[model samples]
Target: MKRLHYFMIVFLITGISYAQELTITGMVTEDGTGTPLPYVNVTVKRTSNTTNTDFDGNYSIKVNLGDTLSFSYVGYESEEIKVKKNDSVINVTMSIAPGTLEEVVVTAYGARKAKKSLGYVVSAVSSESISMSRSERRKARRASKKSNKSLNKALSGKVAGLTISNGVGYTNSNSSVKIRGANSVSGAQQPLYIIDGIPVNKKDIAKIQHIDPTKISDVKVLKDKKATSLYGFRAIHGCIIITTHKGNYEIKNNESYEEIVENSFEKVRTSPLSTFSIDVDKASYSNVRRMINNGQQIPADAVKIEEMINYFEYDYKQPKGDHPFAIHTEYGKTPWNKETQLVKIGLKGKEIPQDEIPASNLVFLLDVSGSMDQANKLPLLKRAFKLLVNQLREKDKVSIVVYAGAAGMVLKPTSGINKNEINQALDNLDAGGSTAGGAGIELAYKIAQKNFIKNGNNRVILATDGDFNVGMSSDKDMKTLIEEKRKSGVFLTCLGFGMNNYKDSKLETLADKGNGNHAYIDTMQEAQRVLGKEFGGTLYTIAKDVKIQVEFNPAKVQAYRLIGYENRLLADEDFVDDTKDAGELGSGHTVTALYEVIPVGVRSEYINEIPDLKYTNSEINRNFGDELLTVKFRYKRPQESKSIEMIHILKTGENKVSKDFSFAASVAWFGMKIRKSKYINNDQIKDIVTLAEENRAADNQGYRAEFVRLMNSYQTL
Candidate 1:
C-alpha cells in the first residue's frame, strides 16, 4: 500500500507522460513590450489540474492527446487551447483586457480553496524548502521554546489554522489543531491528512515511529469544510494532502537501503529461550481438571472464548543498546534514563529487502459510507490507493471492493505494476449509501482468496469508519466471522476513516481477529510512511499467533501491573499451547510495552497488611533477587503449522541502565500524566520532563528538543 503511493507520483505524472500524450510548452508575454507573465496559472480544463508559469513566464504541461488546456493569471484574461496527439509545443502571446485579471479566491467561513477546483484539498508545501526534521515541526509555530519562543513562531505564520503550540518536548500530546475552530469539542479536531490523498494515523506522527520525511516532496493542507467534504464526516476537522515525489514529480528515490537501514542494537538477552507454563483465569476454561484445581465457580452464560487472543501489549523486547552505526549512548547513563531513547532493533535476521519482499494479493475493502463523503474518507481512499498503485512491482496485484448500500468489486485482481486501468477504476468511485460493512468484508476476503498468494502475503486491507449499520452489523459476529477466515491465510489490516462515525474498537476487532494490524490514516505523510516506505511490514507477515507472557517474581516485586496494552494480555496457558492463538508480527516491526512496578519496599496501597488465611500454609521465603520476571514468547514461523516458544529472564536491577530506556520511560510517564492515567502524578510532570532532558543523548538529538518544547507548553498545567 505504501510503496504504491510513492510510485503514483510517477504513475500520475509520467502515467500520462508516456501515454502518447501531447506536451504543451510555451512562453506567455504581452504582445507589445513582450513582457513575461510570470507566475500565471495554467490549467488543464475539465480537470481543475494546474501549475504556474516560471519567473520567465515559461511553462510546460502534460496533457492527453485530445485534451484542452486553460490559462489564467491574476490580471490576465483566461484562455483555453485544444491539443492533439501530434502537436508537441504550443505558444501564445497574451492581450490583457482591462479588469480581466480579477483573482479567483475561494472562501466559506474560515476555510478557503480555489473555487476553480474540488475533490481534494489544495494543501501544499514549498518544493524548494522541504526539510527533514524528526519531529516534523508540524506547525510553523514554536517547535522548541529555546529556539522559537512564541508559540506562534513554531507553526503559526506558516500554515493557516494549523497551529503547533504546547510545551517544549517531543510528546506534548496536548499540542492541538482546530482546522476551522472547534467543529465538535467532544471529537478529535485534527484534520484528515492526505498524502497524495491517503489518510494516515495520528499516533504515528512522531519523529521516530516510521517513514523517512526526506522522501516526501510536498504537503497540502485541506482546511475548508468544502475542501474536506469529499470525506464528509471524517473531514469535520479538515484534511492535509501529502505527495511523496518518490515516483512522481521528479523526486528521486534519494534514500538508499544503506541510508534508510536503521541502526541496529544488541539484544538485551538472546540466549536460547526457555519454555513457559500456562495459567488461565479460573472462569476462562472448561478443562475439568484445571477448574477443579482452582475450585472456580461456573457461569451460566457462555464466555464464547476467542480461539486465540489478539491483545496489543505483549511487550516484545527490542534488542536494547546504542546503534552500532555510531554508538550514540552516553557511557554512564543506563537505557532507563534518556528522554528520547530509541532501541533500534532490526529483524532477528533479514527476511527480504523492501523491494524484494514477496508478491502480494491485496484487496482493499473500502467503506463509502454516507459519513465518508467528507474529503478524507472515500476521496482519500482513492488517492491513497493510487499512491499505492504507483509503488507496485510486476509481481504485486490489487483488487478494490467498495461497500455502502451494497457491496461490489470496483476493480478485480489486476497487477499494481499496471497503472491507467487501476486509476480509471479509482477515478470512478463515488460515495453514498448506508455502511454495509460486513458485506464489504466478505466480498474483499473472497476477492483476496481468489488472488491468494502462495507462500506470500495474501490480505484484505479494510478501510472504513466501521459503522456496519446495514447488515451483519454486530461487531462480535463480524469478528467471529473474520477470525474463521484468517485460518485460510488471508490477513487483514484495518484502516479507519471518518470521525463522527469512526469506530476504533470495531476496526481493532477486525485487525486483531483477522491476523493484521490497525492504523488510523490521518495524513498522507503517514500513508507514505506506511504504504510506500514500510510496505513489507505493512504487507508481509513473518510470524503469526505471537504471544508473550511475563511472569513476575512475587519475591522481588511486591505488586506490578503492565500498562496501556489492556487489549494484549494472554492467559498463561495460551502462551505455551501451540493451539492457542495470538497477535501476528510483521517483518522488521517494533512493538513496545511498559510496566509500572512498585518495588518490594515501597509499600502503600498495593500490599495487604493482613495476609488472607487461604494461603497460610505457605513455605518459608527464599531469595528475592533471582529474577523480576521471565519473558516468554510463543509464535508460529511465518511458514509453520504450530507455534514455537522462546523465553528470557528480566531480573530487577538487571538493567545495565542506558539513558535510552530511562528517557523513554520518562516520555511514557509524560503520556501517563497527560492522559491522567491512574499511576502517574500530575505534580511530577516537570520532574519527568527534566529527567528526560538531562538524560538525553547527543545522537539524532532533535527529539529531545521536541520533548522539551512539549513540556514547556504544558508545564503550567
Candidate 2:
C-alpha cells in the first residue's frame, strides 16, 4: 500500500508539471522608449528551446513553471525572468549594454554572420556607441553655443580607417565620408551606403544626414576586398551598412485624384467656341494602368480620357515652315456613336538632334520622406535618375537638392563630365522623415537660378510619391507656390512614384502652374521611356502658354463636345490672353485632341431640339457653306512673352482617317468604359478591342500590342 501511494504521488507531480508547460508570449522593447527591438535572442534557460524576437519584437516559447526565460540583443543588456504558475505573458525591457561590442554583424542582404568567421577587416559602431556620442554632443551644445555639431561630426572618431571631411564652403551637414582612404584616382572616394538591404546612391547622401540618430540600430564599415566583394565595383572604396529601427508608421491606402466632370454637348449657335489649355501630362494613364495591373478597383476620378488618348505617340508630318510644331486634322465617323463624327487634331513638335540641343542646368529635387522607404520609391528612383545621368553631356551641369524634415543641397553645380562625382552623390540617398515639398521647391529653384544657363534648358525635376505632410501641403498652396516660382524662368517637371498615399492632385497642380509636364513611372521600362528614349522631349521646351480654340460652323454642325480636359478648360477669352498660363510643348513631343460632333440634321439624345429663333437670323452662311470648322492656335516661343497665332480651316468633305486616329479613338473609348461613362457601356468594349488591334500599325516598340493585352485583361476582370 505504501509503494502504491508513492507512485501515485509521483504521477500526480508529473501531471501538474506537464500542465504548467504552457506557451509564453511577450514583447521585448528598449528600457525607456518602449521601442521594440527586433532580432533579439530569446531562450529557455538550460534547455534547447530557443527563438528570436520577430520584426515587431514579439516572441513565443513553451516552458514549464519555474523555468527561466532570457532575452538578449547585441547592444542591449541581457534579461532573465523566472516563470511563475500564473505568468502567461512576460514583457521585457532591456537597457543598453554600454561599451560592449556585438559578437555578430550584419553582412550582405541583412544576413547576420559571426564576426570571427570573416576573412577581412570590418569595423562596427553599436547603437549604444552612437547613442552615447549623440548624448555627449547634446551636452556640449548645452555648455557652448559654438558646439553645434552634426551626426557626421559626432561619428568622426568612432570607427578606425574612416575619414570624415567638411565639404568646402558648405556646412557640416554636407560632410563627405570616406572609408579606408580613397580607392580611385578620378572616381568618387566616398564609401557606398547601404540601408536595410537597399544600396543608396551618392547624390542622396544628404538624406542620410537627416536620419534621427536614435533610430539607428547599427553601423558597420567594411574596409577590405573580402568585406565588400558581394557589392561589386561600386563598393570599391568600401561600404557603410546601416540598420535602422522599423518605423512605427503603418501603410494606409489614401490615394487621391482630382475629380473629373465629363464634357456635355453644346449647341453651335449658342456655345460655338470650345477653348482649353493643351495638356502634355501623361501621369494619369500610367497611374491607371498600375491600378489595373495590380487588380485593384479603378477609380472614376482616375480616368482622364484626353491623357489616355495622348499617352500613345501618333505619326504626323514634320513642321516645314517657321512654326515649331506641325498640325494635322482628320475627320471620320465616330466608332462609339454612329450619329456623331470624330475630329482628330494632332501637333508634332520639331525634333532636334541631341548634340544641337542647348546646354542643360538641371536640378533634381528628391523627396526622402518615410513614405518613400519602399523598393519602388527611392531605389527605383535612383536607378531611373542614373539613366538620365548617363545621357548628360560635358557642357551640361547637374545639381541635387533633397528634402525630408527640411531641404538641403547634396551636390553643387557639378559638370556632367564628372559623371563619377554625380553618380556618387546619387548613391548616398536614404529615405526617412516627413516631407517638406514646399521647402524643397524653394531651394531647388534657388539652385537652378544661381546656375542659370542662358538660352539653355533650366529646369527642376521633382521626384516623389507626392505625400507632402509638412508645410504648404495642400494643392491650392502648392499651386500658389509654383505659380510664383514660374517667374524665375526655371520650369518644373513632376515625376510621381509609388502608390497608396499618392497625392496626384497636388503634383498635377504643381506641374500645371509651374509651366512644366508630369509623368508617372511604374516600371523600369517606363523610366527608360521617359528619361531615356525621350530625354529631349522630356526636358527641352519648344513653346510655352500653348492654347487651342475651335469655332464650329452652324451651317454644317448642330452640336459638339470636347472629350477630357475637364480641369484644363479655359474661358474663350483666355485663349487670346498671353498673361494667362497654359500648357508647354517639349521638343520631339506630340499632342492629340478629339472632338465628337453631331450634324445639324441628325436626331440625337445628346442634344435637345430648340424652336427657331424669332428675332435671330436662322439662315446659314452660304459663302462658307462647305466649311466644317475653324481651328486657331496661340503659342509663345520658349523665350518670348507675346503669343503667336495660327489658323487652319477644315472644309466639309469625305475624308479617310489614318490608323493613328482609329487607335486614339479606341483608347478614348476604353477610358470611358473604365470610367463607367453614361454614354458608353460594356458592350462597346469589344469594338474598342477590335479597333485597337486592327490599327496597331508599325508598333516597333510594341506599346500598341501591350494596350491590346491590357484591354483583353480588363474584359475578363
Candidate 3:
C-alpha cells in the first residue's frame, strides 16, 4: 500500500510539470511610447524554438517553467526574461544599441544575415545613431518637429553611392530612395523598402510616417546583384530593409493592390476601319519595362504596344503648317515575321519653346491620406513640385490643394516668384486619414476655375497612388465626376507615385476623361523628366480629342492586326463625332503606332477563316488600288470644340527601314518577349538586343545607351 502511494505521487508530479509547459503570448514595444516593434527576433536560449513579431509587433511562443527567453532587434539593446510557472505573457521593451557591436543586417526575403558574411556593400544606419543625428539637427532647427526629418534627408551623407531625393507629397515620408546607380532604364529605380521583414509597397511606405522613428531599430540598404537577387524582380531596384521595434497583435491596416484589365485583340477583316484615340501617355511602356527588368513576365493587360512605341523619341519631321502636329508614315517588313509587312504611323506635336509657352495657372491636387505615408510618395511629390516651381516664371501662378478624408486648400493662389511662401506651405503639409480623392478633385477644379487663365495652361496636377476608398471611389463614379469637371476647361495631369495597391485603372480613367496626361514617378529622375525636362509638354495641351481612324484596303491586305492601343479603340462612328471624347496631345509629345499586315498572297496562321458574307462582303476597292491603308487623324485646338482633320495614304514603295523604325521595332519586340504574346513565337531576346544596339543613335543623354543596357539586362535574366 505504501509503494502504491509513492507511485501515485510521482505520477501526479509528472502530470503537473507537463501541464506547466504552456505558451506565452504578448507584445514588445518601446519602453515609454508603447509603439510596437516588428521583426524583433525572439528565441529560447539554448533551444531551437524561435519566432518573429508580426507587423503589429505581436508574438507567441511555447516555453516551460524557468526557461529563459531572449529578445533581440537590430539597433535595439537585447533583453532576457525568465519564464515563470504561470507566466502566459511576457512583454519586453528594447532600448537602442548600447555600444559599438557587430550589427545584424536583414537581407532578401527577411532573412537575417550577419553584415560580415555579406559580400556586397550594405549601408546600415542604427536608430540610435539616427537619433543622435536627429537630436543635433533638432537643436539647430528648434522650431521644427524632429519626426519631420525625411528618411532620405536623414541618410543623405551617411550612405555611400546612395542618392536620396524628395518624393511627391507633403511630408518627408515619401522621399525617393535610390541605391548605387540606376541599373534598369524602364524599371523602377527606387530601392524596394522592406519593413520588419515585410515587403512594404510604395503605397504603404508613403504612410510610414505613422511609424515612430524611435521604434525603428536599424535601416540596411542592399546594393549589388547577389544581395538583392532573392527578392526576384523587385530586387532589380535594390532594397532598403528596416527592422522596427517589436510588439503583440497583428496590425492589418494596409490592403492595397492592383491588376490591369486587358483589351482583346481584334480581327481586321471583321473590323477594317480601326478607330482609336491617340494615346501619348508613356506609363505603360515604362511599367512594362519595369516588369521585364525585374525578371517578371509582363502582364498581358499591362502591355500597351502603342505606349511602348511612343516612349522613344523619333526623328519625325516637325509641323511646317499651322497644324499643331505633323504626320509621318513608313512601310517596312516586320522584324518579327518577314511574311508580314509593318506600317508605322508617327505624330509629332509642334514643340513650343518655354518662352513661347503660355502663362500657367496650376493647382496641385495632392493625396495626403494614410496611404501617402511612405518616403517615396508625398515627400517625393513635394520635391517634384519644387522642381516644377523652380521652372515656373514670374507670370505663372500656383495653388496647393490636399485631400485625406476631407479636401482643403493649403496654399492659395501664390505667384511663382513668391517661391518662399510656396515652399513654406509645402513644408507645412502633413499626411493622415483616409483618401478623399473625389472631394479633392472637386475643390481643385473650383480653385482652377476661380483662377482660370484663358488660352493659358490651366491644369490640376493630381499626385497620388489612386487609393480612393473613402469618398466617390468607384471607377464609374470617378470617371463621371472627371468627365463633368473637364468641361471647366481645366486639364488634369495625374502623377502616380508608389506601388502596391496602386489604382492604375482609376488613374488612367481620370486622365483619359479629364483631358490630361498620366505618368508614373518612380524616381526623382523620372520626376525631373516629367515635371522638368518635359514641363511644357506635360502641362500644356497642344491638341484635344485626337482620334486616329485607319481604313485598310482589302485588295492590298488579307488581314491586319493593330500592335496596341486596345484600350483606346473607339467605335467606327465615334471617329466622325466631334462631341465624342478622345485623347489629348501635349506640346512636343510624340505618338507612334504599328500595324502588322498580311499581304493578300501570304498564308499566315493568325488569319481566321470566315463564311462568305451573304449580303455584304469586304470587296476590293479599285479606287484605292496599290494603297495599303489610309490613315485619318482629327484633333482640335486645346480650347476648341471642333476637330481639324488630316490624312495620309500609305502606298507601295521601297521597304526601307530607318534607325528610328528599327529602334521602335526593337522596343516592341522586347515588349512582346516580356509579355510572351501569342505572336511572339519568332521573337528572340538576343535579336532584340542586337537591333537596339545597331540602331542606337547619338545618345547625348545616354538614354538609348541606358535602354541598350536594360535590354542586355533582360537578356541575362
Candidate 4:
C-alpha cells in the first residue's frame, strides 16, 4: 500500500510539471554572420500563440513543456525546437536557404520578385544591419545630447553606391540620401521612398528624417532606368522600398474617427423642419480612399455620405445676384428603393480669380511631435506647404510656429514674397518630442492677432496628425479655444496627415468651431488639389456661419430622412440665431446634401409606426398646392456680424435630374453600403457602381473615374 501511494504521488507531480506554462525567451541570429534578425516570426507548433523578434532579435512566448517553437523568415531556413522539462531559454541560428540570393528580391509596392526577373541591380540591406545601427545610434544619442542621427545617416556605409549628404543652408540636422547621385538640375534629386507599399512624395525626401527602425523588416534600393520605370517619371532618381514585419501595412493602428449615427425616417406631419450646417469639407472622402487603397478595413464612421457627394464638382450655376452662392434642387426616384424619393440640394460658391482674392496674414501652426515622425506626416506636410508657399503673393504675410514638447516661434512675421526664406524655415523643421497642440494654437492665434489684417484673409493653417498628448488636448478644450479665437477674426484650416494615432474627431471639432475648414492630405496629389489647384478656394472664405433649413410640405411628403450630416444637425431655433456657429464656404467650393423621402401614399420599411397625436391636428393642408418643400439658407459675409437670408421653393413635378444628381446619388448609395446602413445592402452595390460609371460626366480631373475604379476594387475585396 505504501509503494502504491508513492507511485501515484509521483505521477500526479509529473502531470503538474507537464501542464505548467513557461515563458521561453530567445534571440534569432544569422548562422554565418551571427547578425541578429529583426521581425523573425516565431510560432508555437500547432498552437495559435506567436510572436516576432524585436529590433535586437529578442522574442518571448509562452509554451507548455514538450511543446515545439518554430522560427521562420523569408529567404532563410526555418527551424523548430522542442521545449525540455527544464528549458527556459532558446536561442536560434538561421542560415540562408539555398539559392535565396537569386530566388527572391524585395521590389516596389512591397511586392517580392525573382532577382533574375529585374534588369537592374537591386541592393538590399537586412533588418539585422538596420537594428544594429539603430541600437548604436540610440546609445550615442543617450551619451551625447547633441547627437541627432537620422535613419538616412545610419545607412551611410550600409549599402554600396548609396550616398548620404547632410543638408546645407536651412538645417544641418537634416540628411539627404541619394542612390545614383543627383539626376535633376532643378527638381528633387532624392530617390522616391516607399514604406509599407505607400509612396512618399519625392520632394519630401529630406523630411524623411526619422522612422522607428525597430519596425522595419528590410530595405531595398532599386537603381537604374528599368527599375525606376515601375514608379513613373517621378522615380527618375531611383526608389527605396522599406517593408515592415506587419506585412504590406501596419495593423496596430490607433486611428480615431467620430461615431456616426444614421438618420431615421421622420414623420413630416410631426417633424416638418430639418436643419443642419452646410458642410464643404471633403476630408472624409479622401481619407476613405486612402484606407481602401491601402487594403485596410474601412471604418463605418469614416464614410461621411455628404462629404463624399460634395467631393465631386457639380454643374450648378454661379451666383449672379447679391448672394455669394447659387442654389439648385432636384427630385427623383430613389435608386436603391422605388418606394422612396430622393431630394438633392446643391450650392456653388462664386469663384474668384487668384489675383482678385484678398491678401492674407497666415500663421502656420505645425506639429513636430514624435508621433509625426513618420515619412507620411511631417515630411508630407513640408512638401504640401511648399506648394502653398509657391502660390503666395507679395501682399501676403506668413509666420511659422511649431510645437513638440513645447511651443516656439520658428519664423517671425515675414512677407510671402520671401518664398526662399519661408521655404528654408519649413525645411529646417524636424519631428521629435511630445505634442503640445493647445499651446501651439494659442501661440499661433496670438501671432495672427498681432498681425491681424482687417478685411484681409487672416487664418492659421494647422498641420498635424491630431495626436495632442500635452496641455489642453481634449476635444472640448480645443473647441472652446478655437471658438474664443475666432472672435478675434482669425479663421483656421486644419490639415491632417499620417495614419496611425490620427485624431480626426478633435481636428473636425477645431475646424467646425473656429469658422474654418478641414482636409486630410493623404498623398501629393491630394495636397496639390487642396493647396495648389484650389489655392484661392482653400485660403479665402467667402461666407461663414452657413446654415440650411428645409420645411417639407405634408401635402407632398409623408416621411423624410437626411442622408448624412448627422453631426451638423442643429436645433430648429439655431437656424435663425446668428449667435449659433455653422460651416464656412470657401470661394469656388461646392456643397451637396441628399434626403431620402417617402412620398404621400408610399410606404418604406425605414418608417416606424407612430401613434396618432392626442391634442394636436396632424392633418396635411392642401392649401399649399403642389409645393414639395421650402428651403431657407442663412449665411454671413466674411467681415459681417448679421446674417443674410435666402429662400427657394420646390414644387412637385416630373422627376427630371441631371448627371450630377445621378452621380451624387450613386456616391451616397456607396457611402450607405460601406457604412452598413439598413437602407442599403450588398446586392445594390453593383447598381450603384453602374450608375456612377454611367453618369461620370466630363470628369476633367478624372476624380469620378477614380471613384469608379475604387468601387470595382472594393467589390473584389
Off by over 4 Å in 2: 1-252, 611-619
Q: What is the number of backbone collisions in each predicted candidate, taken in the order shown? A: 94, 15, 38, 0
Estimate, for each residue in 1-717, the C-alpha lDDT of model 4 and write its tens digit: 999999999999999998989999989999989877765878887554666775467788899998989897767877989999888889999998776332432332455578778777788888777774646766745633332354565567998888877756543344667776424544446677887776764323433446545667888888777764566445678788787778554334677888999999899988999999999888999899878765678989988888888888989999998899999999898888888889999999999998998889999999998788776788789989999999989999999999998999999999989999999999999887678999999999999999999899999999999999899999989888888998999999999998867888999999999988899988667887999988887889999999999999988888999999999999999999999999999999999999999988876777778898899987668898888999999999999989999999988877779999899999999999999899863446679899999999988877887788788768865
Expressed as tens digits, the lDDT of each residue in 483-554 for candidate 2 is 999999999999999987678898999999999999998766678789999999899999999999999999
Tens-digit lDDT track of model 1 for 28-140:
88768797665566778656355566445678887887688777654455677788666777776777656321122111112234645665445456544555344554432
lDDT rank, highest first?
Answer: 4, 2, 3, 1
Winning model by lDDT: 4
Clash pairs, candidate 4, are none
Best-to-worst TM-score order: 4, 3, 2, 1
| lDDT, each prediction | 0.55, 0.83, 0.78, 0.84
**Number of the candidate with higher lDDT, 3 or 4:** 4
TM-scores for candidates 1 onward, in order: 0.54, 0.67, 0.67, 0.69
Cα-based lDDT at residue 237, candidate 2: 85
